[model samples]
Target: MGVPFEDFKFNRQILNAIADAGYTEATPIQQKAIPPILNGQDVMGIAQTGTGKTAAYVLPLIMKLKYAQGENPRALIVSPTRELAMQIEENIKTFAKYTDLRVVVLYGGLGPKTQIEQVNRGVDIIVTTPGRFMDIYLAGHIVTKTLQVLVLDEADKMMDMGFMPQINRILEVVPVKRQNLLFSATMSDKVHSLSANFLEFPTVIEVTPQATPAQTVNQHLYFVPNVKTKINLLKKLLDAEDDVKKLIIFCKTRTSAEDVYKFLLRKYGENGVKVLHANKGQNTRINSINAFKADEVKILVATDVAARGIDVSDVSHVINFDVPVVIEDYVHRIGRTGRAYQSGEAITFCTPAEEYYLDKIQKLIKQTIPVSDIPADVFVEATGFDERQEQAREIDLQKRKENPDFKGAFHEKKTLTQRKKFDAAKAKKTGQQTDKRNKSPKAYRKKR
Candidate 1:
């Protein structure tokens, strides 16, 4: 109601494309951020993931390019991860399907020669991770001097991954006078300070509270004893619940993700589970995502890198296999489910070490999660418990050795349940020996 479709110079083709994509009303961030973006004004948008921030910028970029002539990279967008960069590219292609704007994605894990070929052929838009962008830019493969627009998506994550130094270097290479757009799910002090350096009197747009998790997700927290106990608890939940359609289990690192994925497969079956992480090749990651979306796989285990920009709805559950260190990451991981007004559940396994992280996440989401208690009947053998836990740890360690970039160092927090069972067995044996030694002569005669 605020702005008619005719008000913006959006071609009929783009309008039809948007309608085809099942989008009618613009989301709050889209409505507010799009106008200034079309006007070539710098914009600082504070919005969480899944709020259509991608469209907020993509539509305007395509509109601007409709009039601009040469395709020597007029728009440059920098994302923190390969998946996110690919997602931005996908959104641009979807929105600009009818337009003539050429979009290309550049990220690590793949060779740069292919990206260089795309750039040489002339691209209107380039979506890339900061490292890859800088790599090619410094080599003079990309002509940043002619860049008309620059966007930094997921700015906070970029800073978190230590991309600021590279970003500064990229900024120095690109032309200073250009339309700048900065978008982040949360506005940390570093993000605010980074915005100060780029945006010039920009229009600020915020649809959701900073670092706030979605309301549609029903969150549940379980206080478990340790890593092994958490695995057992998860197995119980999986076996007991009949309604679980699909799961995206999030670990803090690629190592933990793979380990959890392997454990689920070994415990459940190979047909039901798959793992996605940065260590996986581009084709494998993409194929795994597609398989999960198609319901070919019931469980998709992944790290925080998979949290952003992997959009698949109808996900019945999101399991925090390990509590994320970053509070915003908790929001992002849970966001994989409960999308498009559909209700979903998010379950987190928190050990004593992760309790503080859960507290921070609760504050970030502005609500206390209802605690879920594990039913008391499940049991593990006393003496075999340590051997089982030790074996699991060994497998996880071996996985880390194979993939060095795994990010979940704290997932290895030792739990008390394993130790408690050992202590109880030892105490019972001691008591039995003492009773035998203290038997009276009358008791011995009665036994005879």
Candidate 2:
């Protein structure tokens, strides 16, 4: 049998909170990372999403903090995205419900006045994105000297979003002697470098291989020819009677997300669908997420920004409307489902152009996604000229990337055309010079 929470020896308050949250057994990450964290050691946890890594650290921190302290925050958790920061704050609130510890969340894309006021009122724990945290720090509204614990959640994502400079600044400003915790799904070189700079003799805990998807997620891929065909396939899948209570369709760009959202909206009406992307306002994004979480919307079409930190449990299906260009994001995207040991499905639609990215994603995850034929009910449309050209160009680019000396068909044709023009121009110039030199005496005299 799995180890129970009681074996961890948490205080009564924490144990009660855990029970209230409906958790009895500890996940592997929680069982392993909690002890070292509670022991006041710096920790570097390498685990993918849906592994209860958040609680692994949050529980220990709550147990250590116990109750309210001075006006300044004693612990700070920096997340890569606003959604993630908010999610962490919510988790902290749930686990710290019995205690008097005050928690505040800070992120960008909204007014800072309210956040600044919350900080002014004093908080025990601050969960924020690196940029917003730095903004408040620079504004002199925060006191980092009193910080006892610093956690960088999703450290790899922070590096990917180009927040390393802000992270470095925050690290420099915070007290040098403090308990530091770094967590990430993948251990890229940048994450490694950041860990070396931030963590001091950390107890490295890796519960699973880097970039690996959750075992509960059954992954499938479809080789679609074009966008319309993909849409047709999506329609067929959604129309089926399988368990699709909650679904998230991930698109690579806002335009694609909007397109998918429109299609779904027309079919299912606004009540059944919502869209989220960077183009949407902060309130709209938050509302979309809230609606999805509350089960008011059956489908959410989103970009990669929503892939990393969304924590809606029992997400029945995750569909890749567009293959993520960033291969590492594949793990996080599918992680939205199959949470808390529940079985879920992840379906990817791969156009010819997207196959390159798919290959990279498969390599990163260290497993081949099982390929399946398009459903017989789905109508496969003919590929359009523009789409075909785009796929060809993408394939050519991939070839060039692999072999620098390789010249694609388009490039070779263009080069041949340019050479013909150059040869014609040179021949014309040479003929003109010869004509001038071989001019008749009368013509030459007349010219002189």
Candidate 3:
């Protein structure tokens, strides 16, 4: 029955809470991880975004903490991003609804006083980002010695942002003998080494291969010319396709995310688009995310910072308006859709200069995306390839000249040896033309 809740040996209250949350079946990762976590064993879970990994740790931790019963927070969950941390805190509250357990989320970009007050209230569970958590802990506002369970959510992303040292500091303060659970969408050597340092004799659960997009996701790659052309192409694709019910447009930076959001808003009206990023205040970010989730907004443009821990299902399509700089990020960006076993589409617009990054993405995924050609009518004719190549070469030469360390060996005025080589090639071509002209008269006489 899809990994029954009863099989995990949860208390009746926890079982009732799960049923109340409208979840009877455990997800794949949850089915595998909940058992070990309930048994008080450390876990190393490898699963993609939107795979219910939150529940994999949250449910067990709730049951264990509730049963053991303490006022001070014994469980600590650290996420790489604020959105994810809030989502985890919300999920913990949802699962532990019937219990007296208190859950609070700690993140940056918000006032710390409220978070400090929550900690003072003696929360049983704490979900937070490492940076904000460390800030509070080091400021002597919160205590960590009571922490019994430690969770590093999105561990790979933590490493990506250079938060490993902060994570190490937090780990050092937590109670030495505790259950450690590390979860990441994709595991690398650095992530492995970090896991080695934290989790001891842990259970490893990898439902999907590392960095692999879901099979249900249809991926498309379009080779476009530039940013303006990409916008036009996206407009065309959106207008041409009838089934694009809801969309999440991912941008590479906050500026680009806002730009795309404004563009879409202007074209499609204010109701059509919303933007989410780190720069926004907590209330604003949460409101934007909720609006997108409730279908109040048809298109939500977001930076990679807000991409994780956004668990909205039925997202019909995800458009990479800008190709992600990190290949693994492409996996996470497109992963926003095609979740909950539903078919979804992910399209990436790759400029010529960005093709190298796209190629690396293909190599990592081990499957070449079918290149989509522009429709003949929509194709805007530009300069010839040779002319464009020549222009690019001239631009490179100009840049090198501007550099202080320009080497004379390459771009210096024609040296004697270089001139000799050029003249020799020109002379050979002239002699061939002369011979052809001579043979033309002979051939004409023979024809007569």
Each model's C-alpha lDDT? Answer: 0.82, 0.92, 0.84
Can you tell me which runs of candidate 1 are displaced by over 4 Å? 1-8, 267-270, 380-448
Best candidate, lDDT-wise? 2
Query: What lDDT is reached at residue 115 by model 3?
Result: 92
Candidate 3 clash figure, as a count: 0
lDDT of 2 by residue, 212-237 (tens): 89999999999999999999999999
Pairs that collide in candidate 1 are: none
Local distance difference test, candidate 2: 0.92
RMSD of each: 10.9, 4.2, 11.0
TM-score of 3: 0.85
Q: Residue 127: error of model 1 in Å?
A: 0.2
**lDDT tens digits, residue span 393-448, model 1:** 65456457658775333363544566656655665565532234643222112345
Q: Which stretches of candidate 2 lie over 4 Å from their true place?
A: 416-448
Hey, what RMSD does candidate 1 come out at?
Answer: 10.9
